[model samples]
Target: MAEVATGTTMAERRASVDLTDRRALLACQPDDPAVLAEAHRLKETALLDFGVRDSVVTSWLYAKCHHHIPTTAVETAAVVATGDGGCLLLYNPQFFVDIGLAGVRFVLFHEARHLMHRHLYVEPELRADPVFHLAAEVSINHVAMVRLASGGLPTRAVPDGTGGTVREPVGVDPHEIHRRYAEDLSGQGRKPLSYQDFVDTDLVVYRELKRMHTPLVLPIGLCIHADHVGGDIGELPTDGETVGRIVGEVLAEAIRAALRGNRIARDEVLNLVDRSEGGGDRLTRMWGTLGAVALRGETPRTRRVQWWKRWLADTLASKLREGERLVYPKKQGAVLLALGHDPMLSRRGRERTKVVLVALDTSGSMSNEVVDWITSLVGQTDGVESHWLSFDGVVMPFVPGERVYGGGGTNFQNVVDYAEGRLTIDGEPFEVQPDAVIMVTDGYAPRVSPAQPDRWIWLITDGGDDWPEHHNPPMACHRVITGER
Candidate 1:
């Protein structure tokens, strides 16, 4: 349900998307093995080239998606960000051959940048205005041209099967789109932005477009999911929020990777971080949640916990689905309908609401930094109901910033009982089982089996014993390393 640059009716946009869906991606090679092999090779080379050029952003974005679906549904290539913090990069093999290497690189970079800009993470306000979408398309294309350093459109043919070639123009060129805007504004006796100034920031493009009587609308074929009218009509974009989170996580990951000797990843991440909202406030918040301590530029000696938080975040995302949901009725519904989404409203709630149990064993050994970190982490996380337990010999529920009583011998059993619906909070006994149990403690206490062992995720303090690791049945466990920086 996208607004066609051709000014087609909403009905027409929906119909076109329906026609495209019939061309769903082929999971594996069909009759010709040679074509599939060549396609794979091209994709590999593109990935390599992209990785070499901008390692951090490209690497993280590409890894977040699975790109094996060969589709005729999309004219060029498209990405469907899945509900599970993953993405589907569906493309027509012929399109790859069509655009050639330069085009492919541009498209891949375009898609990743869209993710970076939280493009598909469309909000109601942004979607209600077509000018915003147009601005985004222009900005995305402009950024691609600048970064890839492509002088002109790369519509050169790349060889396909049987000596045939696919030579197709890729996305809407920012220059051409800007030229249209410039001409329209000039006719209206209004000054237009230069190409450089026009495409400077994501919001700037929209603000400038609003200054014009009629902004240029590039056709749907040009970009990925640029719509108040979604590329997938009728369905609400449920996974968009999750995709947004994943995008941040990956960007932060890339930045950390860049810091740790990934020169290519570093350059791209710095560029992305620089251009982000609030002058990289979004990245700062993301890294803080991830407990990515290296962003503090801590001394080289104590930065031993680089990859642990990434691993922890990924693990927790899978198991910690909460019961409640948020609905976007007006704009999100309109946007999804514009895309012709199947279910109309993207309904995304589980049967039961899950409670998160954060049992902090506040023994003398536990650091305030770790406690403060966990408090911030839990405070920022939404959607799930969190129960904080500070325990030593006895289990007791406490609120954030509430001083916890401890110094007694550690008692892991009491924490387990409190989490397993057998304990009380504020004099009220728990009635339901928790969905996930996170224990922050020094592994000095005896281990007891919970009703669900897999739901138990234990974080042991530095140099502390990890009893769960040596238990009869192992569970999810990680070391919470403290630094002196």
Candidate 2:
């Protein structure tokens, strides 16, 4: 190995970062408070105008990047997402003044979209390709125009090589890109996609352009993420591989907030969440960890022909309903996003598996069909623990389809006593405080209060007495209805 002699060693290189760069890193904002306040105002306006969900995320991305100290470090507003998730927005005040109000909106949205694209699509194959960066600009600029209601391409102030900056059109218009592709495709006599179909997703732009004979011609200026060949001087990621993981954590927190009824966060998750979530495990598994509030089909589904299923699903759902307890869902939600689950309910995470007890009244001819329904219902749902019991005068712990010898007498106290943990089966104490206790009986037993009356649910068979309903402090009582459901 040849040792090339340079005056500066590694130590000198480490210490030799420019004073201007040092000042920029200090992150001190000794600027006009009024102007800084306007920056916040611009963000709020963008959020309101960008709809609820997107605004929540855009706001979140810029939440910490508030070191608005005026510097000519870059021409426009730029967010530097560090190796960690932390990012700071640095904008040159004069550059902003040159671009005007509309351009400020453009810059803010454009930068945010860059972070979003980086976060949601971080497969190594996509990131390694240079074309991905150009395709991203096309998508973000098009979306910005539509979202900001800016009729055409939004412009930005670029350093004019003088003491100040000059306003210039920011990104390559998708319309113009489409037109170029149109000409090339026409020359080859191949059909081109309509503008609507062409610009649907970022990857769409990448794919269509790859087929074209002429290379994509991008503009020169400040694009926050593009490399040096594109002549982009804005902040670039030192390592892009971490963008997905760091931003993934942020996305999960946003989803949790959305689940907790943050409207903006919800809307944002819909737009910002990945459409092709092709991972192995389904997201519902993780969402089930959030307990009842995160259950699916709780919210009204789109109007469809299978309306009866909603009723059936809801009926089955009630058996697994959560008890009076709150839980905050944390990493399970991140896993949910990775597994591709959208926020379905409005509740924080709770600590406990959803416990469902189905006590079959073996004293009479019980509905084997009804028992099958219960078994299938619990099977379909995630995060549910099933505890089965069969009782006549005595309680016996049994599996759902297990045959039991009953028909002796109906003493409902036996089941209630077992559920409240006062009694045991096979000489072992059943100590689990179930979130839901379902008793399927012919309604002939003397009604007794379980330890948690509110947690009890009575499912009376046909020609059976629903005595528990008339009891003071009535429990959740429903009928099996004895039909081929």
Candidate 3:
């Protein structure tokens, strides 16, 4: 988990609250400072306990979000993505104090799952449906219950017919909802899904709910997301792109950590990626960008080109074509200008062969198939001068099929030295400056910064460190999934 930011005092948080609207001000009353302080303390404790006992992914994600205690601006708890590339966790202070620590954990987990669900199912139409909203709530709560091992939903204090208050479950019950589905489906002479299959995926839940003729199970208590209560409380409207980027970065870091031997993180991330498949286009694209190869491994032979391969091809194309100049078509420009339109310009690159350096770390095990794949990819690209080097402690140029031998200590600095023309192999100088440098290594050596970090792309094999991604002035780094070899 990332370092937690310093939190604001109760007074500072209350002062920042927006109370401009008469109705909103009336709807949201400030709680006592002592109550607010207690609420904040409870929330902090809940988050800490979550890190120790619950999902590491959630722990990492919530650490990156900004927590706001805005009195009753939010009825319960909500996580909203700020348009400026950040996430905000808003909560009602009084509600927190009332629900206590266990309740706080449940709510926090529920809200985090909501954010993940939003990122996965980004289609506007899908979000606008009320049935989908209920289905999402049901699915999230069920998962939260099973994962947290709370044995039951969190309860909120509610006023009884008498003077005293009693606690009631705060969200829809999955079992109750499932029961309703079963009854409704039986009446229609159709079979209902088992609990496991019903909650298989968010889309599956929605589809099953759509089949029910009975009314959906609405929450008896607060559900800020499904109730749509947080949008009007001065919270920044959720930006899909910002949410995707934030979640993507978190998941990517989690995957890298898993590769570094965090068993809990690996299990959680792999399960998430596995369940999230076929969710939606945005989810699929985001997983692809994060390299599902490390999580899902290689699919069947039918899935010829993996997501990382496509990503590398696109990234290389962009990198190698960096210096291309845009030119305004003179004839078309004049014609468009006369018709009151902006002319479309075309990009053209200088007619020169692009130089590319490929370094393979011989100390680490790399399959011949992978080497052959890289060879074909680089070889087939038009007008690219490719240099292949097999290195462990020393740099040595070799063809794809040539026998390369090295078992010495790994040193990445040696590759940098040779690439920058500062070191010679067998008294032969490397004169050409590479347009891009592709380093395929296990990444167990000392880190080195190249002359041009932008031109360097690091591909760490399975069980390898991806430290370059978090290096000072980070470079393009990815994990290459090597299965069985």
Candidate 4:
């Protein structure tokens, strides 16, 4: 086991605190300075222990989060994303002192896991369900138990029948939840999943729970994370978009570290990606775009798409959807017109055929594989009219697999000029106004400004300069790796 430094200072910690809200939260009842200091020390010690022994992912996540001890505001420990693009861990000082080191570690690990869970499962309807919330608790706590090797959950001292006190498990027990599931499913004549299969993934756990005939009553003393308040959990204070960005960045860095030969990080990162499969289209695209290749190594070629292909498709979809505004549904509008009345049915945006211009650099640098893939993608996509061009020192209109000879110097300006209607191809004016202009090129060309840079997307090849990313008005640029040797 190796020790990892958090790299945060006292000044940075203080700066992360929201001063105005801190003042208002603490106005009711503030903890003694000494008690708060002791709690902070205990939390730091637990985090250090996790870095060395428990989990690198947890250590890395909390290292980036700001810790706040608002005694009265948080009943227990909770991890929240702040509006300022940072995460905060709120804990009660007295609660920490009572729980001691082991309890503190368990609670902190639980909260960190919640942040990860929220990031992976972002559907509004799913989060609103109480069964799903309970399933999340069961899944997370099971992982925490196995990782920490704790015999049972964190406990609190309660009065025994004959003696002073006894420490009992204080959180939802996965085994107990499983027993209830088994009993409920049996009554419905449905086969229940085994404990191992039940907690396989977050989505699996949720789906299985939804099959129950009798809803399991939520256990008393369940952690605040599972308690539904106004159809939402308590720990999620920040918006979904912000939380996704922050967590995605953290996971991306963790994967990079894993690739750099951190064994603990590798295991944790891979497990997360494996478990998050089939959660949603957005989650799948996110993991694919992030680094599923490097994390899981070679994926078998089947119906599954390569990471770069998914990334390109997602990017193109966003580009094509630009300037869309919601309008009345056509069916309703037609009925209203026939009945001679005004239709106020606003459903979705009108479907307009989008034009996409893809110019491939033909200066002995273009890959036929990439060209073929692009052709298939654009050709299969409905409601899109695609124009293919091959450009070097000059521009030539050609379809995929049609070789046009051009060994002259690379000039990006020629492609821009042609697309913007300044240059003509074969004595015909470029008439179509493209919604997205995709340029596939090598680095050996001078950069030129396009009229609508916002609609421009640059895909730089291997060993190519991606100057479009750093231009005055930076355009959308991505590295194009064919992964062919």
Give the TM-score comparing model 1 with the true structure, all chains together. Answer: 0.45
- The candidate scoring highest on TM-score is 1
lDDT of 3 by residue, 208-319 (tens): 9889775463332235343322343333354445566678767766766665456888898889977887898777665555655545564433234454465567568877
Residue pairs whose backbone atoms clash in candidate 4: none
Writing each residue's lDDT as its tens digit, candidate 4 over 1-485 gives: 01111222212212122322445445534448887888889888887787534554454355546545455555556555554555656677877877789998888888778876663235656544556656777788899899888877787776788878987666678888888788889998989999999999877888887787755433322343433222234333554456577887688667555644468989998788779877977776666566655566654332344444555676688878744556778886676666555666464565679999998887746567788888898898778999988888888888778876777798888888888888887788789899888888875677788888988887778777878878879887766665563
The models' CA-based lDDT, in order, is: 0.64, 0.60, 0.70, 0.68
Error of 3 at 225 (Å): 3.1
Off by over 4 Å in 3: 1-29, 53-58, 61-64, 119-121, 215-221, 226-485
Those runs of model 1 whose alpha carbons end farther than 4 Å from true positions after fitting are: 1-6, 9-11, 14-24, 27-33, 128-130, 156-168, 226-235, 238-485
Between prediction 2 and prediction 3, the one with superior TM-score is 3
What local lDDT does model 1 show for residue 466? 68
Is candidate 1 or 2 superior in TM-score? 1
Please give the distance, in angstroms, between residue 316's alpha carbon in candidate 3 and its true position after superposition. 25
Q: Answer with 1 or 3, whichever has the higher TM-score.
A: 1
lDDT of 2 by residue, 211-244 (tens): 7875563332234333321112232343344555
Pick the lDDT winner.
3
Report the lDDT of model 2 for residue 369: 70
